[model samples]
Target: MRWRIPLCLLPAALLLGAADEPQLVPDVSQREVEIQYSFTGADLLLFGAIVYPDGRKPDKPADIVVVLKGPEQSIVMREKQKVAGIWVNADTARFRSAPSFYAMASSRPIDKIVDERTAAIYELGVDKLQLSPSSLNDSAELSRFQEGLVDLRNRNGLFVERPGTVEITDGVLYRARLPLSARVIVGDYTAETFLVQNGRVVAAAVRDITVRKSGFEQFMASAAENWPFAYGLVAMALAVGMGWAAGAIARRI
Candidate 1:
């Protein structure tokens, strides 16, 4: 949501010895939306996708994991010359799954949001819908990646990965199945992109997320209902790749 840092002014007497003393402060940054979707009921799925306008392409057929980030907007400060500083403020309150604080009157309908519209509450689906970078790779060895992810999910009070996570290979799409508990909360849930090393989490990309059942779900329902096949292929391919990687990794061990 809106994160503010208070500034403490130095007493005039304290600065008497310093003729030209200057102080710097953390300025506000821009905000961005991570994901947008439609869902219903406490039992819902998150729909997300990343837009990569420009980047590198690898042919190694690497595994794909999504990590959403804070809202599209974040606070940014600019230092113009030596004596002047600029501050910019933004938020991700509009996105359904922003990392900012979320409040919908506490008792309002899930679709309705009454929190800071110009602020971030919690990060939305960490990067699934936000186009964040991949947090894991094969050569970067570590441990307890999956377990850590499970723990993170548990601590966040979530039952599974944000709905609608997709993987793209050679321009083909795939879907992912995330685990979730029945008692998961109905709010933002942070997620990560884990690098699995020997069946554990080694490296990870962290993302703040939000979860709710609202109009966004309804929007996706129409789209998903029309082209479930496209979604199916993406999900299947991701599964096969993960499975193959796991098996191959075991052989090496």
Candidate 2:
């Protein structure tokens, strides 16, 4: 389902009015996402506006936190146990940076929009991700391996947290709806936007998305990543010429 809008518009920090400095005019409903092969998932919307800063629109009520991140791997997470009875894999935790897809939306519920040290400093939920771990365990074994790596990346949907899925209107538009399944995971993705008020973070924005893998699944993923030994010798000579043409059509049927 090809769709790629987003034709340049991110050089607007000219601060048209520049009052309290709040102006995140983001946008993204697909800006280069082509993962073919019956790829059945995608729904990003992340609209924006929030100009404010004296240019009107603001009588309180202002808090929109949307974050859609992906790309930044380095994980290990293991903790099984049971051992002799079956389980196994004792304790392990590598996580030096995780976020191969993480979504968070809010217009409320982020602790009433800010606090808890500004949502653990920008991590804004997913249990305040910012996963560390590279050694020094303890603290209940690093909170049981960071709650088993956020419960195995939230049951393999690559972690997601939607609190009040943002949706401002009168206060100067704003939207959200970032969903992208089918085990999404290609590369480069970021769409942060926070503006909160009283609790801080007056403004902030960032965008950039790419996803990838297009037609014919991107030509066999670029021939197994740029000709891996001629794509394993042409996939073993086409699996031995389709097993000798299916044994001569099963001996002429």
Candidate 3:
């Protein structure tokens, strides 16, 4: 006797077998960004395509989230308090791994797309960032310092969150524009893209970006790094010369 798959179950099995995991094809507008004296800021465009299995578009649309992160740095945050009519440092918190710059953009508000746990896991928003505080063990104190650090960076345009800024076309193509502040440091950066469907991340991709100094800025940065003593001596000499020139001009006038 020959056994065969039931007609009703055959289609389901075929469909399941044919289905493949979705993939992301991501790219950035600029892979190398040069910072110069005239560098004010830049708009980084992250675009990607979602390749579905068998060219089948899902009935439900997927969400796109893009995160541009700079190199991590250790930071110390100090809380200031008014004591005897003067402001003084009160408490301090040190973070071991804090992103020097971080910006996030999403097709919709992150909270609406993913639950808190998922958001925290991926750090989809500024509030979800895991700034590892090295000094504070108290949750409340750590939270306060984290908030303060985020607020300071937000004011400086280093930490940014733009919900509903990502654009998706036909559930296949997605793009987002994130701002790079003038104060961004010269280092390696990463642009990460996440495709979310049914409150789950289905695919993810990453692109690298390099921010570096150019022209005289590059020369100075290299000099400062390679010859710190000479760089300092030159800087002090220039300061003294400028001061002397200014005084002489003033006397002449």
**Which structure among the candidates has the greatest TM-score?**
3
> Model-by-model lDDT, in order?
0.33, 0.83, 0.94
Residue pair clashes in candidate 2: none
Which lDDT tens digits does candidate 3 get at residues 1-253?
9999899999899778646778899999999999999999999999989999989989999899999999999999999999999999999999998999999999999988999999999988888888887898999998888989999999999999999999999889988999999999999999999999999998899999999999999999899999999999999999999999999999999
Please report, as a residue range, the 10-residue window in candidate 2 with the lowest summed lDDT: 9-18
Residue 88, model 2: Cα distance from true site in angstroms: 14
Candidate 2 lDDT tens digits, 169-238: 8888889897877788798898888888888888888989899988888898899999899989999999
Q: Ranking by lDDT, best first? A: 3, 2, 1
Residue 41 displacement in candidate 1 (angstroms): 5.9
The RMSD of every model to the true structure, in order and in angstroms, is 26.9, 16.1, 5.4
lDDT of 1 by residue, 133-228 (tens): 133343222123333332444466432333224433353222333433333334445444432222222223444445444466545555567878
> Which pairs clash in the backbone of model 3?
none
Task: List TM-scores for all candidates, in order.
Answer: 0.22, 0.35, 0.89
Q: So what's the TM-score on candidate 3?
A: 0.89
Model 1 alpha-carbon drift over 4 Å, by segment: 1-56, 66-167, 171-174, 177-182, 194-207, 211-253
User: What is the alpha-carbon lDDT of model 2 when measured against the actual structure?
Assistant: 0.83
At residue 82, candidate 1 shows an lDDT of: 35
Candidate 2 residue 126 Cα shift, in angstroms, is 9.3
